[model samples]
Target chain A: MNPRKNGILCLLLVLMCGVLVLSGCGGGGAATPPATPPAGGSDEPAAGEPINVGLNLELTGSSAEFGLSGQNGMKLAFDKVNAEGGVLDGRMFNYIPADNKSEAGEATSATTRLVGENVVAILGPMTTAAVLGSIQLVTDNNIVLITPSGTNARLTVNEDGTLNPWIFRACFIDPFQGEVAANFAMDVLGAETAAIAYDIVGDYSGGLAASFKQTFEAAGKTVVREEQFSAGDTDFRPIIENIKTAGPDVIFVPAYYTDDGRFVLQARDAEVTVPILGGDGWGSGDMVGIAGAENMNNTFYVDFVYMDDPSLQDFVSEYQAAYNRAPDGFSVLGYESAMMLVEAVKNAGGTDPEALRSALENLGEFTGISGTMTFDPETHNPAKTAVILESVDGVKEFKQIVEPK
Target chain B: MRWTKYLIWLAAAGAFYALTLALSGAGFISRFMLMTMVQICIYIIMALGLNLITGFTGQLSIGHAGFMSIGAYAAGFLASTYGGRVSAALTEALGGAGGAAVYYIFILATLAAGAFVAAAFGVLLGLPTLRLRGDYLAIATIGFGEIVRIVLLNTKALGASSGLPVKNSVGWTTAYWLMLLSVVLIYNFVNSSHGRACISIRENEIAAETMGINTTKYKVMAFALGAGLAGLAGGIYANHMYLIHPNSFNFLKSFEILVMVVLGGLGSITGCILGAVVMTVMNNALSAFPEMRMIVISVLLVVMMIFRPNGLMGTTELRLPFRRKAAGGKEDVTHGL
Candidate 1:
């Protein structure tokens, strides 16, 4: 063959291979229309076409664990609804999951692809950075986006409290979690003074730490020391020593499990055990593995849901049986978000985005694994109870539930 | 024969533009594909700029994304704050033709502003760093990139880490034409006398200086021009994406653009365009399978490098069979470099 022809052939072969691979991976399993008629004849709404929903999550990056668990939880909820004859009187819910890979650009592209698929609603791109990256697209298209774990207060509402009509989340915002932790530290633990060690570069950590400090101080508690560290910091001994010097009754580390675990280990190794406190960022199982069982004992963090809660026992057991591990805060929130969206779709009686959005806006007091959820009309954030969990012998033991004011 | 060639080129350009307009308007192309096309256009502009500096001029700048970020933020801020009023006023004053005319004018102004500001930064960064060689210059540029990111991250007016959301000012049609214009302009520049001087500097800096090339001025000029083009890309990107974040223009992004320039073939305009399109398509295509996307892309890069070390074009231009040669012997000067 001529060299030019060979080159063209090679290019064509590669192009064909790429298209095959993309098409193979892009097919989200088709949803079959219901064949059977409703058993409850009279009041049953007519069975319609299946509803297409999109799930955008971080499946293979630093936040993969959260994304995977969220996927499992969402799938479980979806399966459960399908088994119960589906929502909208038999219109099955079909979820198309895309991996954001925990990058902002990826999040935008993934969400855009999902939008292209004509989904009625999008479930999650779990982290705050990913959520913010895709929020503009969602808002511009007027698509309903219900993130499972994005907790930045500025997400659903602007800083000045103007509502973003298209955005909502299942998990409580950072300020709420921060306030709950502060209240728990001051009232329950009887802590007079507190110190904070936060990751300055992280939106979640910085925002949570600030809210905690502000609330703690407003309640007549002294925040003795505030130390900062960016992500990828290896040494926390110096910061721990500084906190020890200030001698606060409690120390708040508003960071993810990776950093929190190292801080816990380094703090304990230094023998500076003043009851450590944090937010939902410390809910990952990696925390126990990183900080050892002994080091993790007595550490407390506020979270959206606890797997051990009696109300969530069925889900917890089912999740363990399926994934062979106990579900974490992210999983529970994911399950709740999916369930909430399903309920909204059922209530709205259609898959239209505007109808589903209004249904969500007026979602009053719905009971789930994560307490009662009622989205505030002004800000699309749900008002729900946050549970304080203490690490006892490497186990997440539910301590107390703080109800919203 | 020359007129026939020109007519063919014009017809091809017209057909391409019409296709883009039809696809975008008819909703035949998915939003995902449209977004990907916009990204490809932006990356092509950016890679072309980088190719001019690193490929043609032998200046290794690892921080081109820094200039892009500056342009993105500058344009994003302007569009967010004042674009609506200006566009609205133009639409009112111009009557029927005003809307499109205003859109073109506004987009062009923002892109030009972004390019100018980025060029200014380029001059600021290039003046001192152009004195240094290779690794030192790379480090200096990287530091400049980091400085831009840090400044944007801290500056509340630029939305800090939360990011600034610009109005969706430009569509795929506008972006497509702008990118094509940039490619043509850069192609023409690469064939100019100044371009030959830049290439000579790349071949041997000391020799070029001895040959009265004024190496420093050419180097700085190439750097500034490259940065200005990058800024133009950033402006379109911000307006198209409707949002800009400091994190979007970090080291990883710069590395990605570098990969395109290297993968396409150094000192090759056609190569840069090819590389940009292929990479952008591959990225979008493989995104669905997140687990193996990175691995697949890395393996492909490795294979391509092994097969064609100099890249797909290897400093060679792809010429049409019907085109006549240039009047002078100017083409010979570009071959050795």
Candidate 2:
């Protein structure tokens, strides 16, 4: 080889070495689809191996706490299943979790890599935007996507009045929660005028805001102002300054815990003393820590059933015993989602996703930790009541459960 | 010899295109893979352009992606609104060849707009900072890239904070072809006479000036040309996904493109392509194991810097073995096609 050729060969050699090593470490064990009957079926494994499940959660970055909590919750279920001698004929379940870092693009990237790994089923992504990016990939691959927390209403609905069978959520969609807040604002608080502020960049926040707006307007409440902010925006002073002039009875902020919590504090700091309303993104205890107790006072939001509910003392103890921490809304949803998957597997009498999906479609009157649930065929969303909670003393205390209309 | 190289090039190109087409149809090609490959192509194009400046003409650029953002948004607005209309009009205007003409027009406009916008940005950013060298130029370019991203992030007309959604009508075939054609044109251009001129500037700017090479003209030309390519990549990318989120084209993205150039060796076009592909594959494959990904890329970069800092395939083209019948002397000079 000529000297120039040697130089080029060396460069190619270096890159190829990296490529070879990276590619070699890339392959993981194949997922074994579960073999047991569906939830209502006989207790016998009817088929092959357990399924490989993929999860893309924001285990780091802005939503790290939520992601970690959800993963732990899912892990609890995985442990229980494996300990009991696995799902579907002793075929063990494999759960792989990838961190999305709370970015939609990263979440999608993670989902792609997971698909390459050939996971049979996916249980994620925590954020709605993340879910949106992953849905096409999952659906195109004919794999089932069971998002434990994604609540955007559009996920379930197509342009036509049919269901997106490939996609299912263990958690409640935004419309119900948004409506619950709307009712609380109009009927409970008797607030005639409400101003809405939410992070425009997020599909989750924006979708929930739309629901709240639609519900509030239907109830004949006058909405004074609608303001938007971007994610990673620290200063809410500008939005707050604008909101102060609007002077609504209450300001609805359907945003993530980080932004919403800080925004709440900023609103108070700016002397815009009106009560703040929010959605499920305000569920975590971390919000109080991030925004301070004084900032979060008088702020109310809708969320999943309380983790510390006395009625579910046994469940709470089991969760705490398993995870060594008190559960949050994500924990419940994660646990319930795993259980829901198990139920479908049992009902189908096999680990086959197609059969499980069929069973899921026909699923009725199933009770879980979240609440009793039913999945309508047209929209894969499960029906459940939204619980309104006030951030009293910087802690979420359940006010009332608004049953589905 | 030229024929043989062309034949080899054609075969390789065919294989690559076919492979991409097949991969695009694979059930496992998730959103991440699709987007990553798209982004990698964008970076490769941008790096190739910047290579002409910094690598080939000895002028550094840290704001390559900024020019890309401009091209992206510009072509994005056109493709989202006008691509179809123009296609319709061209079909009517050019009789049976209207669709083809519209496509050509779209490509031409996108490339032209990208070049025009990038040249403007290059001039705006370069004019003030031309006197700077090395670290200073890098800092200025990096600052300019950040400013571009921030401006895009804040601008309401550019979809505000949410960033724009890709109009969602992109065909995979069109994207793949665009990338392929770009690589070929760039490869050819880099190996041409002008390419030698650019390389001469890189080797000794003062010497080239002493030889009446008009160094400033070449430097400016290199920056403008590089900016144009970056713009073209951005435009295609914007149309490819039908989305333009400003954050996606930030300083970090600029650095990633720079990494492609640096990792590939300064003046090596072949190195850049290989590096782009390697980086793209690594990003898609290692994302599953997130912790390992950062460590892996970091170690790879470190090892490359230590062992083969010039890059993989630096200034070398891949060639097949052949014979000169009469002489019988072994000769394997790989010419970049």
- Model 2 lDDT on a 0 to 1 scale: 0.73
Clashing pairs in model 1, backbone N/Cα/C closer than 3 A? none
Q: Which CAPRI level is candidate 1?
A: acceptable
Per residue, candidate 1 scores C-alpha lDDT tens digits across B1-337 of 4466557767887898889779878976778888899999999999999999999999999999999998887777888888878777877888758676866677778888998999999999999899999999999999999999988887878887777877777878778888878876786787789998999999999999999999989999999999999999999988887668788898888999999998778898877887898788888877767777899889978987887677766776545543324423534332411
Which parts of model 1 are misplaced by more than 4 Å?
A1-48, B1-8, B85-100, B324-337
Displacement of residue B180 (Cα, Å) in model 1 is 1.2
When just chain B is superposed on the true chain B, each candidate scores a TM-score of: 0.93, 0.82
Candidate 2, residues A1-405: lDDT per residue as tens digits? Answer: 676666756755656766675556433422333333469976644444556678788776657777877888788887788899876677566787888766655666677667765666777877665676666667667777878887877676754665777888887887777778888988888898999988866456777778889988887888888899877789989888888898899999988787887898888888887788988887875788887887777888898787556766776788889768788888878877777777776788765567777777677767887678887776888888678887778777778787765
